[model samples]
Target: MLQMAGIAVAGSCLSPTYASKSRLLVSIPAQLHREFTPPLPAFISLNQRRREVLPSKSLQTALIRCFDTNKAASAESEENAKPNKVYFARDAIVDAAARIAPAVANLYARKGGQEEEGEMGSGTVIHEDGYILTCSHLFFNKMDVTYAADEEIIVCTQDKEIGHVVDAYVDLDIAIIKIDSPSSPLSTAKVGSSSKLRPGDWAVAMGSPLSLQHTVTLGIISCVHRKSYELRREGMAMEFLQTDCAINPGNSGGPLCNVDGELVGVNVETMKAHKASGVSFAVPVDLISAIIKPFQSCQMPVQPYFGWVMRNVRKENLEALKQYYPTFPNALEGVFVQKVIKGSPADRAGIQAGDVVVDFDLQQIRNIKEMMDVMVKRSGTPVDVIVERLMLGKNRLVHLTITFEEKDVAAPRPRL
Candidate 1:
């Protein structure tokens, strides 16, 4: 899902950024099977990484240079001296990078039904215990092997060695991963209530945009209470915190924080057509919280589901319902119920399709979200349903009690 900033991660960890250098060392014991190492060992420079080190004065100097040299250090400085902070923003991002990047990990995986390397994705470490949250597709198949951060994960300010996801549910398109890393720099971002965000609020996205580690981009809330789906991603239904933030490929699973860096949402998708522009999208933080209960302590609690769909009335179709619905107050511009599923609490309460649901209890219904808010609070018990049913071009006031059924989470739904 590391595909887009507004639409999806297209739903993965990230796109590819093959490292061109052969200098970085890697070592995997030959006894280690595919279960613990990459399936295709050829693509990886294992021999180069496996070079052994010896302890000596010269080795000490080499090791020290490797450990202490910062990316900010110039080639000349790195050759003769230790590294120092050269830029303010880099310093700020690096300051929190270790703590934050651990949550955002690079995911290497296999392509669908093929014996080849698939694309990569990123993840966010939500739990200090090493639990992470990422787009589920990053681990999309029977993985031949997996890897995490190495000694240099800190250099990337990312968790180098992350535990692969042992469990996943694509219905939510979200996964929980166990990772290993040092203490975080930024406290896990404060998971604030999503309902607090409004259009035009400040937002900052932090992650490996385009696979460049610890990238940050800023924007404002473009819209809220989104009720949309990613048609390309098999119609994954996801309500998001729409923002103009510049979310690119590798930003998936990273945090969309407020001005103060409180976790508001997971950078998920970006809306795009022919040409890419400023529009971006993110998973609602509350939804991310709901999908993965594993991060409950680190994520905001999710609001409940109301479970219905409605539409605003169009003047062209208004005459068709003039008979049974008469309360033309304000032209019924609010959302109207289209269909209520059978055995749904609405059906149990005697509500039917074609019923123009105007309000719930007393709260006026706007769209799916507001109605859900009204119904979800009354989860088990019945609540009053107010509607104006069209009967022979006349308005008929109808009040029926409705209840909400527990959302059937296993109905082949997308990884929410």
Candidate 2:
């Protein structure tokens, strides 16, 4: 044997501690290189051959099974303690706001000399590709001025930084707007049944109050099926949703979302601000479907009544009128009978000039529009009516079964 000599080296240099952990780690190299094989432990003789076979899939499956068993056990352990859902526990209402914010939009209107400022109104996003539902008042051509096609209408939202206008609708008070996200993905509120939205279920309204955009207010659905809006021939009957959501001039056409974030009503006509010490009104989504249906049919529905002309009557005059309306509800039930046009539906229904309409179909008539609504919706449908002879103490609640008489279709009235 050749004499082997070596200088003294530290014990750390050839450490025995790592020998127990030593093993061969193998990989197929891209390029074949010369590699000297390391010797096995003395427990294995040099004559003993090494098994260089691939690991069996049975072994892999066994490892996976063990891991799965541990995981399932852990899952069962966790399941023993029921975790509280953060949304229902605390963020139920907040999540609703987030869901509904995408649908509501603002409206802007400016008359000829109204300082070129815009009026704030709300609208619902009814269609994904851009369709919305709002009140006629928002699009009511009070000034006969057309809003620009790309009017800078602001879309306010909840659970967000602020609101910005996305787009505008010219004919419909409804304005559809896409969210600010470059990504088109957004959570939209599922519209609920206005017919089923009871008077007690949670009622919520979103509006930009007094320049504060996307302000959320809460109230109960105070009433349902309240008489509202004049009816139109060939249009769906208007059944209203009345609420106390503190709606105002700005709240017109806002969405009255339910607790589930479903739109129960469209914030439409509200009580006059001074008259609104507490009450606010919304056009039920059921009725909204009617107003929009004619447009969908590509034809304008004939609204029977014109705009309401408001005027206050003195207490003495109101009392004097009550003498002729003993069957009417005190003195506030009926207003002065204006000129009824010849050959109109009101005229066909025998509602003549100087006829004081005290009540219609058991509903106490407070204004012309409400009475017109009942008469129009019930067109061809009979109703019990109460009217006082013009300037006479005699009054009668007559069940007048009105019929829909076709008038001259030569020239149609303007869209309301």
Candidate 3:
């Protein structure tokens, strides 16, 4: 017997006969049971009355089983929801350099048949038949003078070969040299688009820095469309793609490649002398593509002569111009014409020194570099230009028609 709530309960409730079924039994004193008993509703059945008076073992067991099942399902769900492990390869730069390595070669230029010392630089093979592209300044002296026609340029690849300057564009500082055909087909770099490049993209420069051949340096692009004037390199109308890759003297004319091993630019200049690290410049592949055909055909690329010295409108320059003109537009956004050559296209079109070129050939002109690029494509064609000129202390828009004239650029004699 067991004592519960001042009532004696029979321990036989745990017996096999009662435990085998879903029933429980309890024994209580007669006086207490009658005192605690309450009247049941008429709708309650006999079994319901029994259930209200005694606990049901089947109901308790069912509740415990349901809770255990829910807990186990939740644990399994959490285990399956965990993320999976991933893997990555970190040899992208190494792979990229290896892809374009075969096309890169070391170039040595000798003048007057002197084998003691000569100009040394790097070059990229652009054609499988042995045409190499390099910087024109590589063959020039400190005075910015070209070498004699009889100078010898030796190309060192897997094997030594004689090279000759086929053609050169001095203004852009680009030269193409052709080497004697090798016994096997030469590897050419896969050319990529420079116009698609953006700042912060991976830039890999492969060249010979300080006579170190087949050297590769890695960095990121710093700027695209860097104008020549911004670098204080006047008379060059083209723009450069600036990178933070380490480029040295011998690195000039080497290939600037992307992560996919495609050539995007030709390495040209670096700011190592200024004690700056990772500051370099390259000629954009678009400009290289533009001159490749002409160079191969033994013709010099024609430049359009607009015959005007211009500057991009900037806050500092505009402020300075306002002090003199007093009527210059304060919010002007265009290329400012500083001087117009006499009898030139701009002069004949009524463009004056103080005019701001707002539009050209139906396209808006924002900077001098952009204007130059457009002029190059539309050379030898008639186009309309809109300028903002101050008239009676007020800004007036004037539209004029002008035809671009092709400037005569002499091509170097090709030695086949």
Error of 3 at 10 (Å): 38
Candidate 1, residue 376: Cα displacement in angstroms equals 12
lDDT per residue as tens, model 2, 1-416: 01111111222236556433543122212111212333333222123244222112213322222222223234454335343332323566777777787766655543432323545676665544233455544533322222222222334333221222222221223333323332232234467778887777778898655655677887888788775333221122345677777776777777898888888777765666664555767766654343333223212234222212111122435654345434333334454433333443455567543455567778877544465456445533345666555334544444443443332344332111
* Candidates 1 and 3, the one with greater TM-score: 3
Residue pairs whose backbone atoms clash in candidate 3 = none
User: On residues 1-416, what C-alpha lDDT tens digit does candidate 1 reach at each position?
Assistant: 11222222222223323222322212222323434554431122123544332222222322333323123334464356543434235344334433343345555542242322332456665555555566654443212111121111111223344243433433344555544334553234446667789898877777776557667787889888666653233323457778888877767767777655567777776766456677777777676454333344433232122233344454534554444334343345445544343344455577654666677778887443455455445534557877766666666767887654443332221111
lDDT of each structure? 0.51, 0.48, 0.68
lDDT for model 2: 0.48
- Model 2, total clashes: 2
Q: lDDT per residue, candidate 3, 1-416, as tens digits?
A: 22463332353443657544634444345545766766443222245324323112213322322222223234455344433333224798989999889989888776666543533788888766677888867754312221333466778777877776654544466667777456566787878889999999899998888778899999999999898888877443578999999888889989999988888998988975667777799999887564443223323233233445455565545666666555466445787665555555566678887888889888887765566466556545677999898888778989998864343534332342
Error of 3 at 193 (Å): 0.9
A best-first ranking of the candidates according to their lDDT comes to 3, 1, 2
Off by over 4 Å in 2: 1-90, 110-118, 141-188, 229-237, 290-416
- Worst lDDT window (10 residues) for model 1? 142-151
Q: Which one is best on TM-score?
A: 3
Q: Is candidate 1 or candidate 2 better by lDDT?
A: 1
